[model samples]
Target chain A: MQEIEELAARLRAFAEARDWEQFHTPKNLAMALAGETGELLAEFQWLTPEESATIMESPAGPRVRAELADVFSYLIRLADVLGVDLPQAAHAKIDENERRYDADAYRGSARKAPPLSGA
Target chain B: MQEIEELAARLRAFAEARDWEQFHTPKNLAMALAGETGELLAEFQWLTPEESATIMESPAGPRVRAELADVFSYLIRLADVLGVDLPQAAHAKIDENERRYDADAYRGSARKAPPLSGA
Candidate 1:
């Protein structure tokens, strides 16, 4: 959590020093997050599953790391701007997901659990 | 960060318990991450900048939080599977970006700095 907070702080300073926060509206940040996510996907687009699994050890490793970092950075910045606690939000969602996708009922299936009544 | 490690551990357990690790290949996780990110983008797709800036205070806040969690989850899972330290990688990239984009030189600009020679 410190690492994320530190990254967020650094990002804030970077934007502030350049007066770039004006452009960091949630909409812009979200779009930038999507663009970076696309780049992350592109890193593995042509790789087989096995290759993708081993990509961090391959020649393309650095680029993949950079792309991953870009996605992470934008997500952190967006959350910071929106006043959302990134890790806490994630923890809550994981908790919800665990309950929703009961192992006994969803074993080995990619399908999502049906929404709970009124959920 | 413990938050990330814990999230990754939970995801690993979630998949293992359901016998779904076989489907968590890097390629699949990366695509899933991108899909989730697109969903995040959709949360703000129609909002004006001002609307987006205040969206977390609006009725759509919960959905945006959920979408952020989804993106974070898949990113954590993918990094876990590929053995990348997400926070560390992000920190390193931020440091690099700081050097690459001198605030003094690129102030208020959206354009990326040109690559250093042979970098």
Candidate 2:
């Protein structure tokens, strides 16, 4: 996670150097993250399912990557503002998903998984 | 990145165990990533700017985290299918941005910076 931390530190420094912290509020970061995510999705909006698979190999790859990186940067910034350790939180949530998305019943189903037996 | 790699491995194994690999293509993962990102954004859709900042402390935090994890999982899956090294790609993008988004010229601006002066 050194790379993740380093990139985030660099972003923080960039914002701090510019005195942009006031605008670096979680609200703004989340909105920015959403906007970037929307941009990322837009790159695929007109693609066929097969074409979507090769987007990274297509002419749109650079733009797509730029949008993706933007999404990640905002996500990291949002997590930092909220005091969440992103990788740690991600690990915990994925662990829970392992239980919730058990393969025994969910395999081959494209539908949303129902909740487990108990709350 | 060990953690990211571990989660990807586990996800792969889960899919393999269920013979879901046929459905785990890059196209599907990209769409799923976009869908989860939209879900993450929806948590803050109606919040005022002030309210957006405290979402983690609000009742919606868990849902937000769950949606974030989903975004991450699908992103990882998509990159894996596309043969992209996500961390490296992100690092490279940030470095380029360090040059493109120079704080000296961009500070205090809420607007998009115009393209750099040269080709």
Candidate 3:
């Protein structure tokens, strides 16, 4: 938790020192996050499911990690700008999911939390 | 941090309880994360920049949060499957970015982490 807070502070300091907040409007930050997420997916796009899992053993490993880093960087920045406490928000989400993804109900499915058909 | 880890453990328990590890492979988890990210972006696809920021005030707010939760859910699962420590990885990325995004050199820009032109 301290690490996340500290990292956000450092990033905020960097942004403030240069006054980049004007450009870092919530929309722009969300756009950046979405773009990075796309980049992260691109690194896995052509690979077979097995290949994607083992990507770290291939030449694309570093590329994948770098993209993941980008995704995370933007995630933190977006939360900062929106005043969202990520850890708390994330916890609440999981708590919600606990009921949504009930082990007794959705245990064998790979489908996410979408409502069941005819439910 | 505890919450994140605890949520991961709970998710794992849910998966294990139903023997869904076969579908919880790293590749599959990453794919799910990517798909959710795309869904998140779609929520903002038609909005003007101003509209995007204030989406929470619009009817799309809950949808946006749900999508974000899905993104985070898969992200945590991906890291868990890969044996990656997300907090550490994120910290290292910020440190690396400190050099890459020198406020003195690259302020007022939103070009992401690409290399300089002709550098």
* Most accurate candidate by TM-score: 1
For residues B24-95, could you state the per-residue lDDT of candidate 1 as single tens digits? Answer: 899988888888888889889999999999998999999999888888888888889988898898878878
RMSD to the hidden true structure, all candidates: 3.6, 4.0, 3.9
Model 2 DockQ class = acceptable
Candidate 1 lDDT (Cα, 0 to 1): 0.81
Clashing pairs in 1: none
Model 3 lDDT, full chain set? 0.67
Residues A59-89 of candidate 3 have per-residue lDDT tens digits of 9877777767667677777667666666666
Interface C-alpha RMSD after superposing true interface residues, each candidate, one decimal: 4.0, 4.4, 4.1
Which tens-of-lDDT digit does each residue in B1-119 have in candidate 2?
36557766866776676666777666556566766767777787788878877888889988777666666666666667666676676667667766877777787765655221101
lDDT of 3 at B66: 64
- What DockQ score does model 2 reach against the true complex? 0.40
Using lDDT, rank the candidates from best to worst: 1, 2, 3
Model 2: pairs clashing at backbone N, Cα or C within 3 Å: A1-B1
On residues A1-119, what C-alpha lDDT tens digit does candidate 1 reach at each position? 37678888988887887768887899988988888888878888999988888898899999988888888888899999999998898888878877777778887776554211002
Q: Which wins on lDDT, candidate 1 or candidate 3?
A: 1
Give the residue spans of candidate 2 off by over 4 A: A112-119, B112-119
